[model samples]
Target chain A: MQAILQLLVSGVLLGGVYALGALGLNLIFGVAKVVNFAHGEFLMLGMFAAYWLMTLTGINPYLGAPIIGAAFFLVGLAFYAGLMRFTIYKPELTQVFATLGLSILLQNAALVAWSADYRTIQIMPAGWESIQVLGAYVPTNRLVAFLYAVAILLAVLVFLRSTFIGRAIEAVSQDLVAARLMGIDPDRVFLMTFGLGIAITGVAGGVLMPSFYAFPSVGSFFVLVAFVVVVLGGLGSIAGTILGGLLLGLVETGIGYVAPDLKEATHFVLLILLLAVRPHGLLGVKGAEKETLK
Target chain B: MIEIRDLHAGYGDTEVLQGIDLDVRAGEVVAIVGANGVGKTTLLRTIAGLIAPSRGSITAEGEAIGGLGAHRVVERGIVMVPEGRRLFPRMTVRRNLEIGAYAARARPRLKQSLEEVYALFPILREREDQLGGTLSGGQQQMCAIGRGLMALPSVLMLDEVSLGLAPIAVKRVYEAVRAIRDRGLTLIIVEQNVGQALKVADRAYVIQGGRVVLSGTGRELTNNEDVRRAYLGLTEHA
Candidate 1:
């Protein structure tokens, strides 16, 4: 029973990172209706940025998050303006291919520049400590990261709900034609939304770098987890992603404790079962079929 | 005032509207009536700048607006309610109305426009927080009209406002249309119900095969013998 409790605690902490990772992907997909296959590459790039900044400038990875996030946001904006906008109005297959090409290009670029070495930034400025809660030991860094993720998520939610541009994003997501009728320039909204989505990954990458190693293909693993969370939570639902992240985190950790080898397999099996039983996802909108992909 | 001279437009290979000419003076309600697939909606959509006219000039107050996009046209004070009530389904009635004033040019007058829209359709005020998709057919129609008014447009175009409504709901929508006309805005309505269209319009045009077949004062076209027989279901044709 104590072992089970310990696993649950670790899972919850890990879920925080997953939720943050999925948030940006969900936001971009929800608003733009395009799957950013290169989203994981963005994460990989962000982690590397933080790692290099720390190595060269001796800056803390935590302190470097906003800088990397801002840089990623600009890159995301340029990407949308230069590429995604043109292909968005095209057929679904075209959009998919365009983004996939971008993903391949970015991944290979990172490989050429950084090589295949797994790199980590060791910046413990001393006095780092862990805490014990209900007989489960929690690492100080994971706790801080979890709290930071939660704070950031809440801030994003508030911004999306209260600000004018945020509401415009929501309006565009619902119906682009109707949004245009309301005098919203769909192109501008798309550009900014894409930027915002990428920006979120910058935050996630910075936060997770202290504990996780960075590699050219690192984003692939987390991006797959993000897709699973998105599907489990329901597409275009911010709240759903948060819940899905926590639930999956707990489930995976619990299963890992029972059979460590089956941890990854368990998630895929659950996903398949969920798809077969509830295709709309846990909190998805009704009649929200595959049409959203279009 | 609005004017379209020698307009040509199409979707891909087939030309939907060929050399169409029309005019709508300020404070006038003009009805463009036609059978299904005759390009009535297409004509309104073109005027609202949803589709680019292949060739021709659309002048609003003497400024050519043919090449402008729909949002740009709205910024110029021409707004469309669309054929169907294209309300954002998940949005609240209030948010849907708020989005109507997304044009920065319309920002200063947003409060007055909101009040005017709520006054014109009190039902919307009552259900302001309800999701637009949950509204009844009549209520949704009202919301659609209200949304257009929220733009504070000088010229409002409604496409098929009377479609898919009960007789009583249709009457309510028309009454609102009449009130809109009383406000002295330039109105262009595309309607299938000839009786209602004729009753509300100051001038009327009947379109056939993407061309204007007949046009006159509302009463003149309503009283035309051929129009009565073909469209009004008079006994001579039956």
Candidate 2:
């Protein structure tokens, strides 16, 4: 029983990072209706940014999260202004192809600059401290990361609910034409939203560095997980992504204990099953199909 | 205050609006009536700047606004309530209204505009907390109109406000139209319900195959034999 409880705790902690990663992707997709193929690259770039900052300046990764986040936000804005603007109003195929091309370009660019060797931040304190809860040991870094995730999620939720610009994002997500008629420049909203989305990944990368390794292709692995979480959580629903992340974490962890080799297979199988059962996802709004299309 | 002369517009190769000419005077309510594929909605969309015109000029207050984007046209004080009552389904009624005031020019008077919109549709104020998607068709139409009014526009254009609504709901929408017109805003309405549109409009135009086949005072268009036979289905009675 203690073993089961330990697995559950660990799963929940991992789920927090997954949730954070999925949140930004879902927000950008929801509002802009563009599936950012380069989303994973942003995560990859963020982790590298934090890693380099810590190595060069000796700034703690945790303390440098906001700085990295701000830098990524600016980078995201430039990415949108430079490449995304031309294809935003075009056909869906154009958007998909353009972003996919960007993803390829970014991956190669990282390879040329940083090389393919895996690297992990070697913090002095080493973050492996654990706490005993209900006879289960939990890592302190995991706990801190979970708390950080929750805080960011809450802040994002409040931003969406309380601010004028946030409401415009929601509005554009629902109906682009209607939003435009309301005097929102969809281009400007898209640029800001894309920046905000990528910036969250930056913060998530900073939080994750102590617990995970960094590599040129590290983002590719987790980006798949994030996509799974986003779809399982119901495309554009923020709260749904959080729940989906948790559910996926638990499922993956539980299955890994039973059959470690089949853990990845189990995740994909469960995703397919859930989609077949509920096309719109568990918490998705009915008739919200339009949110998925541009 | 709005004029379109020799306008041509389309989606890709096929033209949806061809050589359309019309004028709407200040404080006048103009209605355009036509069949489903006759480009009634496209005409309104062109004027609202959703689709750029291929040729010709659209001038509001004697300034050319033919090819401006929808957001720019909105900044110029033209607003549209698109067909099918397009509301932000997941957003609360209040948020929808707040977004309606997104234009910089409308931001200063947002409070006054909100009050006016609430006055025009008191039910919106009552259901402000409800999700927009949950509203009934009639209520959604009301919300769409209310959202347009929130912009405090100089020219308000509504496309198919009466579509998919019951007769009583149609009456309520027309009443709102009359109230809007009474406020001295230039209004352009595209509707399939010929009788209801003519009842409130100052002038009417009949579009067919993307061309203005006929146009006159609302009463004159109502009495015209061709319009009556084609649009109003009055030939059977005649």
Candidate 3:
């Protein structure tokens, strides 16, 4: 029982990071209606940014998360202004290929810049690493990441619910024409959404740096995890991402215990089955996948 | 005042508004009435800066606004309450009303606007906490019009205000529109309901095949034999 409880705790902690990662992707998809194929590359860049921040300045990645967030926000804006602006209104094929092309370019760029070294941050004091919670030992870093994830997610929800710009983003996501009629610029909303989405992903990357490795290609692994979480959660729903992540995490951890070698295959199988059975996801609104921004 | 001279606009490769000229003076309610495919919606859309007019001039108070984006046009005080009440379904009625006051120009008067909107549609105040999607069609149209009024626009354009509503609900909406116009706001009403539109408008235009086929005072056009034959489906005998 304790062994199972330990896996559940670990799964939930891991799910926190998964939720954070998927939230950004969902935001971009929800508002802009662009399935950002290069989302994982942004995570990779963020991890590198966190790694470099620590190596160069010795600032803890958690402390450097805000810095990474701000930088990534600018990177996101530039990405939209330079490339996404053209493909934003185009067909799904155009958007898919455009982002896929960007993924290749960025992956190779990171390979050229950072090489393939896997790095992790050492943040904990010598003897105080794990905490005992309900008879299950949990790592300090994982707990901190979980708290940060939940706090940031809550903050995002508050922002969406309270602010004018946030409501405008929601307005655009719900009905673009109606939003336009209200004098809200969809382009400006798209820019802000992209900036916010990428920024959140960057912060998540920074937060996860202590628990995970920072490598040029590590994003490919995470991107798939994010996709599973997003699909399971419901596309474009913020709260749904959390639910999806937790579910996937528990499932993956359980599978890891039962069939450790086939753990990775579970994601694809679950995703395929979920798509076949309930493509709208567990919490997603009905017919949402069919609703495009244009 | 707004003017459209030889405006040509269309979806890609298919023209919808071709060589259209219109002049709407301040404090005058102008009605554009036409059949379903006769470019009534297209004209209002182009005027509101949703669709860019090709090979023509759209001047608002003598400034060319043909190429300006919708948000900018809104800043200049031209707002549209679309045909279908396109409320943010998941959002609350209050938020939907608040978003209408989102433009910088209207932000300062947000409080006043909200009060005025609520005053015009008192039921909306009662249901401020309710989701916009849950409202009946009549109530949704009221919220939509109320939302447009929240923008504090000088030139308010309403597209098909009576599309899908009961007769009494339509009467209530028209009454609110009449009240709005009495306050000296310039209005452009586009509708397939010729009688209702003409009744509320000061001047009227009959559009066919993307061009203005006739124009006169609301009563003149309403009484015109050709307009009756074409729009009202009334023959010489009737």
Candidate 4:
């Protein structure tokens, strides 16, 4: 019974991490309709940025997040202004390969500069890395990341609801022509969204770095998880992301508990089933998937 | 005060608006009427800066605005309520109206613009919280126009406002257009619906094959045999 409870707690926490990771990707995809293949790379870069910031400046990732967020926001802008701006209006395939190439370039650059040595920062006190709660041991870093996810997600929802620019972003996401007619600059909205999305991704990485390793190819792994999460939750549906992540987390945890060897296989299987059975995702706006690709 | 001199534009290679000359005086209801696929939309789109003209000049209040981007054109107070009543479907009606006041010029007067819009279309006030897509066809058109007015536009260009609407809905929309004219806003209306466009228009232009074949007072064109036979769809022919 304890083991089952532990699995449940672990699943919820794990889902939180995935939710945070997928949020940025979904935001960019929702507004710009650009599926960023380099999303994981952005997260990986954030992890490294946090790691280096810790090692060099002695600033904790949690506390130094704002700085990382601001920097990544600029990187996100450059990503759009320098490269994505050109590919965005092109064929969907062009966007696919462009982001893929970026992923490759970023991974290689990180490998050349930092080497493949896995890096992690032990932020929690000794023996306190795991905290007991409801008869389950929750990793301290995971709990912290989960809290961040909840706060950020709620904040994002509020931002989307209450703010002018946020509504403008949502406006652009729905109809570019309509947005333009409203005097809302779609290009500017895309720029802001990319910046905001990448910034969140960077912060998510920094917050999760203590729980996960920071490596050059780390993004490749998380990118798949993000894609699964985004698809499963319903692309462009912000609230739906939480449900999707939780479902993925629970299934994976359940699988991991019963058959540890098949844990990784669950993601792929769920992705396939979700795509085949319900392409729009559980709560996604109908035909959202078609709107982007077509 | 918008002037188009020999405007030439098109979609990549095949030119659509070939050396078309048109004029829209300030505070006038000008209508551009034509049959289907006659580049009516293309002309409005070009004027809105969705497509840059290959040649010719567009001057509004003495400022050239031929090839400016859509957002830029909007910033200069020329907003187009596009064809198909392209409301942000998922956004609430209030949010849709709010987005219309997104430009720098409109932002300052957002509250006033919104109130004006709600006053113009009382139905929008009731539908404020409803999703834009959920509104009926007529309501959506009004919301689209309300959104355009939210921009505090110096000149409002409406593209096919009556298409796909029921007769009563179309009448309501034109009534709203008349009310907007009473508010002293310059309007450039594109219509395949000839009679209605002419009725609201102070001056009307008859466009054929991408060029203005005829221009006169609304009554003059309304009474013309060519316009009557070609467009009014009154006299049946084999």
Native contact share for candidate 3? 0.94
Candidate 1 Cα outliers beyond 4 Å, as residue runs: A124-129, A287-289, A292-294, B236-238
lDDT of 3 by residue, A160-253 (tens): 8898889999999889999998999999999999999999988888888888898877888888988888888998889899999888888888
lDDT string, candidate 1, B1-238, tens digits: 8998988887877888887889999999999987889999989888888789998889999999997998899999999998779898988998888888878877778788889999999999999999999999999999999999888899999999989999999999999999999989899999989889999999998988878889998999888998887788776544
lDDT ranking from best to worst? Answer: 4, 3, 1, 2
Instruction: Answer with 1 or 3, whichever has the higher DockQ.
Output: 3
Per-residue error for A1 in candidate 3, Å, reads: 3.8
Per-model TM-score, in order, reads 0.96, 0.95, 0.97, 0.97
lDDT of 3: 0.90
Off by over 4 Å in 4: B236-238
Query: Candidate 2 clashing pairs?
Result: none
- Between candidates 2 and 3, the one scoring higher on lDDT is 3
Q: Write the residue-wise lDDT of candidate 2 on B1-238 in tens digits.
A: 9989999999989898889999999889999998888999888888888889999999999999988999899999999999999999888887788789888889888889898899999999999999999999999999999899888899999999999999899889889899888889999989899988988899999999999988999999988888888888897467
Best by DockQ: 3
List per-prediction Cα lDDT, in the order shown.
0.86, 0.86, 0.90, 0.91
Fraction of the true interface contacts (Cα pairs closer than 8 Å across chains) found in each model: 0.73, 0.92, 0.94, 0.78
Interface DockQ per candidate: 0.76, 0.82, 0.88, 0.77
Relative to the real complex, the DockQ score for model 4 comes to 0.77
